[model samples]
Target: MHISRQQTESAERGPRARTRKLMLETATRLMQSGVTPSVSEVAEAAEVSRATAYRYFPSQAALVHAVVDEALGPILDWKADVPDARARVGDLIKTAMPRIDEFEATFKAALKLSLDQWAQRQAGTLGSEPQFTRGHRVELLRDAIAPLTGTVPNDARERLVQALSLVFGIEVLVVLKDIWGLTSERAQSVAEWAAAALVDATIREAGNGA
Candidate 1:
């Protein structure tokens, strides 16, 4: 049976939309279940033909990357309204901890894929770190720690920046969560406690005998 051009276009559009939705849904399921399913498995779970899945997502890697970003979007969005730098840093982590914990497997997979890409790249084509780029996490930490340093001697600003960078940085997140196996909530709580303590100590030291 021959289909009209309009019918063909409509059919194509419906399947394309459904395929995209299926891809995202399947990826989220994989993340929740801690399953590293292949494209074929995802297609089967999504109830789409393998070719249909490939049409929406060119490759499994692309699908996985999109899913991870989607999962992190709400966490990033919540941090936008935070005005206090110190609170923002702590709040950002606290807010993300539960969501991050749930989607931890997805982000971990994405990181592994990114590392593999870096390894395959040429010298000039080397990739940068995706998890720790310029964003709310970095900016918020910088702001929160800035006021902790009072009008000290020269290079005080630089010192505070370096200290905060070392303490509440993205690398800390990876270490606390991945290496130490600390729950996201616990890690954020510890980090916030440390940041608050540093601020208090700085003020106390500056007011010594004054």
Candidate 2:
């Protein structure tokens, strides 16, 4: 019986993939529960050795980043199906807001880590820790507004992107839930409305040559 090289490679990769998945799932659960656990802590919770967890995630930032990717799974790949820029932006908001609400805790933890890194950098103690960078929205939002590139003024396109960013993420949760005490459904409706309104207002402002 001949086991092909591909088969051999797949067999070798199987355990590594499973280990990585297990660690990631554990970390996601931890962050979802509102605990920004370190790798070693995740190992304990996952019943894996510290050495194993460290091998998978070298630092807390890495672990948190993994959790974020998992939380943002489908949203990260979102694309507009419609041709209309307004409709596309609206569609993107409708698609992403629910996941943002579902993984609310995970995103909150990621935001806190981002803030912590900024403060640490300012205090000159950031050291060699890998920065928990976050600007995916820049690309995602820009892509969502791709249809508006030449139709709207360049600055207006950018202004729409910037304005849309304000309605897209954890900040929505903070405003609608923490501040306004709205439930997730209501929060989502408000986000959807705000996103549509922003797109409409930006286009109208551009049309008026403002």
Best by lDDT: 2
Task: Go through the candidates in order and give the C-alpha RMSD of each one to the true structure.
Answer: 9.5, 5.7
- lDDT by residue for model 2 over 1-210, one digit each (tens)? 944334533675765877777888888888888888888999998899999888878999988877887788778778776778878877887788888888999999899889889999999999998999887778788888888777689888888889888888899899989999999989888888888888888878877878
Instruction: lDDT for model 1, please.
Output: 0.60
Q: What lDDT would each prediction earn against the true structure?
A: 0.60, 0.84
Q: What are the per-residue Cα lDDT tens digits for candidate 1 across 1-210? A: 944334533666663666676678887787667665556778888888888787766665657755765776566455344444456556655666666666767766665655665665645454442322223445445555454444433354345455655545345568887789887677777777876665555445555732
What's the true lDDT of residue 172 in model 1? 56
Clash pairs for candidate 2: none
| Angstrom error at residue 40, model 1 | 4.9
What is the Å distance of residue 112 in model 2 from its true position? 1.4
Please give the clash total of every predicted structure, in order: 0, 0
TM-score of each: 0.58, 0.89
